[model samples]
Target: MEGNEMKAFMKRVDYLLVGILLFSLGLNFYHLNNAGTNTYYTAAVKSMMQNSHAFFYASFDPEGFITVDKPPVALWIQTLSAKIFGLSDFSVLLPEALAGVISVFLMYILVKPNFSRTAGLLSSLVLACSPIFVAVVRTNNVDSILILTLLIAAWAVMKAVDQKKLGWLILSVTLIGVGFNIKMLQAYMVVPAIFLFYWMAVKLTWKKRLLHLIAATVVMAGISLSWAVAVDSVPASERPYIGSSQTNSVLELAFGYNGIQRLLGQNKGTKSMGSASTAVQNKDNSSTTNTSNGQTPSNQSAAASGQAQGTTSSSNNQGAAVTDSSSSSNTQAPMGNGAPPNFQGGMGGKMGGGTGGMFGTGTAGPLRLFSSELSGQISWLLPFILFAVIGLFAEFRKTKKFDMRIKFAAFWLTWLIPMMIFFSMAQFFHQYYLSMMGPAIAALVGIGWTMLWNYFTTNDGWKSGLLPCGILTTFLFEALILNQNSQSKFLVVGTVLVGVILFILMVQRMKKETYSPALPMAALLALLILPLYWTGITINKTNNASTPIAGPGSGMGGMGGMGGMGGGARMAANMGFPGGAGNIAPEGAQDTSGNSASGSQTQDGSMTPPTNQDSASIPASAPANAGKTMDNRNQLNTALLSYLEKNYDGEKYFLATDSTQTAAPYILNTDYSVMAMGGFSGSDPALTPTKLEKMAKAGYVKFFLISGRGGMGGNQSESVTQWIKDNCEEVPSSEWQSATSSQIQTSFGRFGGETLYVYKD
Candidate 1:
């Protein structure tokens, strides 16, 4: 290409990138309030930035001691924006929105060199406008960061392959390492897929491949290990123990139980338990079978044991399993409890369970099984099928000689295979975990669409072209009809108008004397972007519904709904309360188990526990400093602080009935802490005994607040309500605590919520 032509091409690409960025910004900006807003990660990041003044020094709850889980990279970007722009919802989210736009630009640049300019443009546009991509990036989440890193890594790997540049290889490894810091071992999954693809491409001897593999391994290890070392250096008490570290806690919970455990319809550690029980059940069945056949049961046992050992030996041969005993040991706890156990011979349980007459009985909990099925349907498996089929054809045709097929194949594998293997072998799987694949899927669709368009227009001729045109025309017509019928609906009308315009352009192209293939594609790209943008706008507008507002009859600064206290009570009950209501010592509380006494029913129908029975109810006398009105700020702050000082010291009940309203107060108030156990319902004195007993044993309580108007009854699930009934304690006398109005204003205006409960163990 000539210098002027190259310059023009670059200019076009730049213009297109800017346009996409603006569209992305607008889409994300408008949809800030969507129900499916970013998850806990966004909240965590925002909290970190608010606490820490600097970008690199991210902290959450400066008064408290919780470090941010994600790496500094993304947080650093957000922190800078917050500091410079002034902290607000928009400021915190701008970094992700901008990164998302940049990632799209990078995707275009990476594809443009290998594919036609039209293909590059279409691919980038498709990714920019993908429903999932737009939704994920617009919200506050680590997904945008993951997408950015994956794109950079792909670009780096492509450069290395094309130029044989070791620098690019190192850079790619570094990016993966950084990705690991963002979310632990999740990033490492891409390595195996990338290496396998490379091996297939080069057909190199094992020794040659091993060298590259070792280099990549060392780089990944260095980056990940450094963070691990830092975390390990902290005292165990100070460490963030998000889950347990046992068969149920550490290996099972983190990897299998909480990881893929749900996929098999088991609890966090139930998969391991289920597997072990099945093994024992199989052994018992085998013994019975041999005895029935008039053969020595010992012989069958020995043979089964030998087979188990042999399988273990084979796994050991590949260093996959350390010993057969390992699986047996891990499965023992769950088996004893009659819970489903996960296979523990690394990933070897699949073979063992299959041969040993152990498979899912299909009686696993409906919710968990349904979740697992949905996860499998949406995750890497579906994308792999889509990409492999399209990628194979693209490679075979050799229409574009620029090696776009291999790059995409490599990129897809690198991101996908590792995650699939890890999750499949894990004890649990959740839909959110699959969010990482959104970008990869978007990229694949973009490329696939471009390839299909090219094939029809160039190879299959006019007949093939008519099919896409017809589909486009039909979409346009439907959109036009919807628009005319729903003029007030901005999203629907805007989408239809965009589709019609794009279809008209495509139709015009079909009739032109000489078609510029890019015209139709560009139009189609616009159609995709416009709808997604409109959808995002709608979501943001709808998210406002989540905000908690003050209403009439809401006591004390319009606070009415039970605070998170009620939820905490339910969680305590579910955990198996070790002590009786209020008498049982909490997990972190001082030991008073010996002094603690169980409760008996009172004449008023209250289950008055023996210890602190009188103190359990709110004190009748207000403090000497207490004033009549709660209108002043200082007085309110002092009263709130006093309330916290009195209430926050011991285990307190948390009610999570109103999650959306609850987060702000729980987050803002240091004196207040929450335990998310179950939903909220009106207070029932009759249910207090069992609930209080559970809370005492579990060492916590969640008091559900009931407004006179009847709060959150039919809306809550049976399991959730049952959990609350089983866990929480109700104290009827502890009502209507007085506060200065200033404290009320501070708590209500800054962190909107209705009722508050003091959780006691």
Candidate 2:
């Protein structure tokens, strides 16, 4: 215990922590140069970097047509990165990657003081190799920065509690506010835990604590709303329409769409503006319904008008399935009235389902975090953490006295429990949102490990029993998950075997009345093997940037075939268990109804899923953008850009489309801006007839590209198409044909089949 010995020990710890951080950096930064990782966000970042105004508004297009659906703080960081590094796939994603790396070090700092250095290192290591954490930081998602900011706030709060410094507490609250800017209300999920920890551990009187919390709340609100207030102050005519807000209001977007609507999914009155438009566009009661239940009005109009116009065979073929191109070589019959709905709306009613039922609990419940669909994302070690939490509580109950360490455990639990409940029952969350649970799980694992080590190394036979019981239980849970989801028989058998061996070794060591670091180390290392292996797969394999979950049997953009996990559409079909080959639901392939991941057919719609080969051809980093209704295929077609530039001179907007997905690649590829007429879901009224007429008449938009099927559901208006047919002449597919790559054409459905039409009014 001499000073020199302590210094040497500390040096080794620092080196190990530094090494862990570097390892995380390598995983995140390894395939940095891949393009279009998540074109939705990448394109938005590119657009934001075009000018300061666009940057401030977080515009998804260069001309400030529409901002992205989320808050701009995270986008601001990415914009700054792109500005410094110059725009590329790597530049836009660098800030988040670096944030993730910093978070690893911060987790260690937050844990080491109250717990042993061993606990802190293990915690940091677990977080560093977390599968979802690795996947999220490597993408353009706002979550990486969001999670990091929250961790910083957590650290600040912990320090304030330990040191009794009011300033540290203030800084903590301020950082949470910053986190709110990064991801709106999602960051406030930890508030209850923060408040409780402060109240319990700050040593302040009840009155002082209440007043301090009020002040912190006020500051947090002021900081969180700073940008939202500024954006809302702008006139709708001046700023881009708030992309997903029902009333084009930032506040409404925050509290409504991204807030409650996300938590509740799509409820009666709380549907997103996009969903509303989709409903209107796809209303079944329309006059355009099948004239005889076998012939849709739109199809009738197409057939009659086509022959009247002396349509060529190619154009006739084009009318059936391709974009409204003049050169259609192959012809097919128009879709009959019995055709299935073209587009699925409102995530297929998955968002706002009822709460998980009672103690039995439904999808959104206390156990929702451990559900089949969610567990693999970040819950690989959840069973252990949960058991450790129970053990910690039991120990505190026995002592009947307040321990700072127990209080810290309380804060971590408080932080995790509510969020767990919220995510469990919340109807509309994506899997990546589970990363919010990462830090809590890591801290609990560390604290629990240290506590168990102390008990087991001593002669406390009864207390030591908790270790084997917890470890064995976790092993059983993981074994079940692996058996159901994994393709690797070796993995399942090996994991179970290792558990048995570790159990025996620990029991033997305890009985011998000996304390060997080797036995405990072996046990802990064995526990880590499975999750770390999965994390490695996540780092090496292609992730479906759209769904953004990591594990075996991921649908699209995954190494689906390797494990027993089903890949691609096959996994989508099975839907039996998490990480199973059939688990993934492609972005637009199915509604939230747990329906089969089969293709939706629109009678005349041009959209198609990428062929398996085409999907395989996608780079490890490139996530295809076809979910929902937008298709982001070959955005950088040199031929298309040159053609648009040559023929559509002086146009303010280079191209116009009905959905954001269709416009993303074009905006990203060209210096010119592209307008998404209806916003993300093709339901926004941003480009009504009047607006389109005004822009088209003014030469603001010279070319309109009709690449994919329309309708928020499958009810695209014939009037919209009729208006274009009446006012504009169809540009031949030949001019833009060069823009279609064989990769896109042969895999036609993959990128909405590149059905090109250049319409000039």
Candidate 3:
């Protein structure tokens, strides 16, 4: 390559990256416009930008009560972008979109040495335009940062291998550390892949290998530990709440909850693994009891433990304690009594024990069937696995002449395999978490594609190459068409017809003189881009036209649906809160008709069900209680509210509710402080009166509002309600009236038959 050629190549790369950047920008703008900031991460960013003038970092709550859950690296970039561009939805998401584009460029650069430029371009294009990648990039999430970090780390490691440079090794380790800082523990998963690459490339003696490992570990430790040390130096009061730990330090939260708890599920802070285990056991016991004797085992023991302390029953109930009681009527001997069995020693053993040793048992057939449903979720890993297999085959076939890139790919596979196995064994798995492997997957796929192309051309197999290329071109074209249809069916059909014509023209050229694979791939890329363009336009219009709907059922008028009752789905409506299509009453509003609205049925239906105005939405709010009648239910509510106000400082106190907006105005508008109650739902036996007492003791929550009639339909456990009645004093009607007057409440007027009970510790 001459100097001018190299310059031209670089210029082309720059042009490609810039084009991707603009494309990503348009997509993100559309998504933000359509969804108006979809996930919690985006909401957090928007909140920060709205409240704090600085963008580098913004607290989730205005009081700086909770810092953003994710690390500040991405947020800092986003904040700076917003500052320069002027904070709009687009500005807030610009950092992720840009990072996404840079990742594509990095992919091209990283793979260019191992594969042809065409292969590199195709891989980059696949990543840039893939629905999954584009979706992550368009949203304000940490996944994009994860992708960038992984790519940079992979590139650095490859550089080290190519140059035999310790500096590159250190740099790669440092980048891994940075990834950990962004998302705790996820970066470390790449180590196995990198180490495997090294071992395959240059086999070192055990002693040298040990030394290298130590050096790499030290570098990684330095990168990760620096943040911990800085965070630990801060005072306890300054730290966010980790579990129940006295120190709210960022380090404690990161290390204890995000880092350790995520892997081991042993965080002692808020919700401990022990408690979760115990809850599972209790649930099992109740189900068994119900089946055997038509009586549910009392969850009094679990209930008494409260929020601060989690309980794990002893292993006595293991055998008899069915993991899923719904499966079979046949009773097995009790494995143990208290805690669930800890079978982390062996993956198969753990899985078997957790599922009641059902793997081979024909009786446990239903459980196997249930597990099969998750196959689709794990399918994303297939592309990477396929690439790894191809790379391994390529490396072994060329053993006489070593390809450093192949060796590097081998190392990545080594790292990826162990991490995949570990995650698979570990009980918790989600597809998004696999995103860390996206770069490696892209690299492998690029290599595999190149290998196939070379094989055909070397064999004078132009006709064979035509078939595979044609197939790939068709697949890419169809994907584009389907994606485009998401915007407008007519537009996509027209585009597909035009693409068919272009494909025919390309085929003609191929027949004359084997046209470069790049030409067809480029055309396919254009087809894909078309849909995203229209998608961007749709999102922009949606954003511009959106109107804030009142939280569900407050009659603040907005879209309505069954899924609108819960905060998550309901907030998706214009108002960004509950009470849209399905939600009947707003957050605090209750149905006075004594007809318990089936909240359990709603929850069981779907997390985000489509809006069914007739069947889903709560038809009307409960009629107002006219006379100031003090009944047992009203007394219980009043006593709870009165006790909370009298014992706790009303100004500093907040009602513990799931709805933040509804709760916020009532608590914040009035001198009283409020925050959303974060915990398992009321149905969980884990929530006890003692837990409420502990929450009050820790100043986490001051009051608990108990609606007399169930609107959403799920009721508080009998044990929880009884405990509250026995231990805490309810607010008096007179005090409730006074507090109501003091608080500039939003949903209070709409509370049909709902009773607000405030209680003190």
- Candidate that would win on lDDT: 2
Q: What do the candidate models score in CA lDDT, each in turn?
A: 0.36, 0.56, 0.40
TM-score for candidate 2: 0.78
Q: What is the TM-score of each candidate against the true structure?
A: 0.53, 0.78, 0.57
Cα lDDT of model 1 by residue, 445-547, tens digit: 4555555555445545543354245335434443443343233467556655665666666655655456565765555455454335434443442211111
Worst 10 residues of 1 by lDDT: 308-317
Give a tens-digit lDDT track for model 3, residues 1-761.
Answer: 99999998887665664675566555544544223222223323433444442122333333333333345666666666655765444565667667777888887887776767765765676565544455456545566777788778878877776676667777888888888777667667777776666555544566765677679889998887776576545442333222111123446445543444333322112222223332332222121000001111111111111110000111111011111222111011111111122322223332233212221111123222113221111222243245336545654665766567566556656655655555454322222344454565556556665665454334433433433444344434443434422425665566656656765655565455344767544554554454344233333321111111111111111111211123322322222112222222111111111111111112222111111121111112211331121111011123333455566753233455322222322321123333322111112222234444555565555455543312111122344545555656665545554343212122222222233455554
**TM-score head-to-head 2 vs 3, winner:** 2
**Which predicted model would earn the best TM-score?**
2
Q: Clashes in each model (backbone N, CA, C under 3 Å)? A: 58, 21, 53
1 or 3, which is superior by lDDT? 3
For 420-535, candidate 2 gives per-residue lDDT tens digits of: 87877675455667788888988888898888777777767577766766677677666766765644788778778878878887787777856877777667666776777767
